[model samples]
Target: MEHDVPSLPEEIIVKILLRLPTKSLLKFRCVSKSWLFLISSYDFAKAHLKNSNDDRLMFGSKGFSMDLYTWSPQSAADHSAFGGTIYPPLDQNLLVQRVCIDCPLYEPHDVVWFEGSCNGLICLSSSDESLSLWNPTIGKAKKLPNSGTVLDFDYYGIGYGFGYDELIDDYKMVESLSFEPFAGAPTLDIQLKVYSLRANSWKTLLNWPGGHAFGGSGKFLNGAIYWSVHRLDGPIEWVIVSHDLSTYTFSVVHLPHLHNEDNDDVNVDVKVLRGCLEICCERNTHMDIW
Candidate 1:
């Protein structure tokens, strides 16, 4: 008696394997060298990543530890309502059930919450000053090349998104870094450099119009990175500087001023409340929405 060999078409196997989460796929790669190569291929990873994005767009928040949550509009009565506090808390069991079963790349640390999310990716920087571009769904990550100098005066910014560009076929990451003297007083000699992920290199851009300082975290949205730019002298006005993710250009957007009583000791600040951007007035009685 003779036995028949069990076999399936390559396309069928690929279709089935794509359904597995990234972690399981990584382990299964050890089954064979061919499987490892197939799983690690850029094209295969990109396809799987696109499929994962289609699955769901999960957002996490930064706290003592990252809190991962999936937005389920279907669970609510009115999906069109923006401010309805209808989202359910995603418990550990549910996280295991959903993300673990389908997303093999769902490591606890990989779900990092940045100051903001943009274009299906999050901007992350390490305390050691290392930067990376990460897509959590498919576990695809690219470490950005560091700025050569650790000058105490250096400042860094990152932006990522898709934009209409006649020259490029895919989206890109635009990073900007500026350097100024720490002790010589703020001057016009500050230098700025911009990096393009597509080109995998950096180029010097025009200097900022005036002496400006950035503190806290940066937010990426609508093909630009927005951050608080502090002016040296003004009515305590905070400026929002936006760097075009595609063109690598910088522009300023005005922030709404807080209504305040004439008190010299009063202080105001800007912050993101829930998901909306808001300004906290000095009196602490009202929040002005811009």
Candidate 2:
């Protein structure tokens, strides 16, 4: 007597694997050597990643050191299984991708961590001007070469963003510079610099798109990095800026009109929700989200 094992064609297997969640795919790797080989292929990696877009959330904190974790939202019906508590970490294993293993900075305040996660890679930046690309899944990291422009803290403030360029199959980090002249530096300047992981170098950009100051870390969505910006020459108003990683172009997104009588307490934040840009505002007792 002979036992017959079901076998799937490689093409069919690839399609099936692409639709599965990362957790399930990781387990299926043990099914056979063929499965593992297909899963580890470059084409399979790209297809699987594209299919898994917006399936999970990757978030990190800045205080002290830095920590990154991945969370998956559950369905409404699944709430009953949790006994009313939707605590993900308690119910599932939260993949802590990075935990400041060997800190690059002596003083935590001296350097800041700005992060953007894409296709299993996390890009990190520092206030003191350090950049790196890391794949948390493989525990591999590559420090980006500096753009060679020194920032004189006395006159300039900088913000960083990261995203992937599908056209060239590369990843990029865009740095926005805001300059304020003091005693000798008479001309106010605003500049931009971008680093390419594929080329392993940085290039400076002139004609600063807009004089808007980037408030904080940006959110990556639709192959671009989106940040909440404030125009330098205008009032204390907020606007959303998007920089396409592939084309290296800039576009401005107007925020939703808000009827805020008390502007002092109004707070706005930009985030990526389910593959779309979301602007959230809160003031006093009411909140408006768009």
TM-score of each: 0.55, 0.74
Tens-digit lDDT track of model 2 for 1-290: 99999887878878888988776877888988988898878888888786775556667664566655555554423334444332334335332233453333234555546467677777777656677777655556777777787666577677677788888888888877777656556444767888888888888766456644566666778788887866656466777878888777788877655646565456666878676778877678877778
The superposed Cα distance between candidate 2 and the true structure at residue 143, in angstroms, equals 1.1
lDDT of 1 by residue, 15-110 (tens): 888888887898889988888999989788767765663333344454555554555434333343434543434451232122231223234455
Q: Candidate 1's error at 42, in angstroms?
A: 0.8
lDDT of candidates 1 onward, in order: 0.52, 0.69
> Native-vs-model 1 lDDT?
0.52
Measured by C-alpha RMSD in angstroms, how accurate is candidate 2? 5.1
Residue 110: error of model 2 in Å? 12
Among residues 3 or more apart in sequence or in different chains, the pairs in candidate 1 whose N, CA or C atoms overlap within 3 Å are 21-104, 22-104, 23-104
Give the CA lDDT, 0 to 100, for residue 56 in model 2: 60
For model 1, the superposed segments whose C-alpha errors exceed 4 Å read: 32-34, 53-146, 150-190, 196-200, 207-211, 262-290
Per-residue error for 11 in candidate 1, Å, reads: 3.0
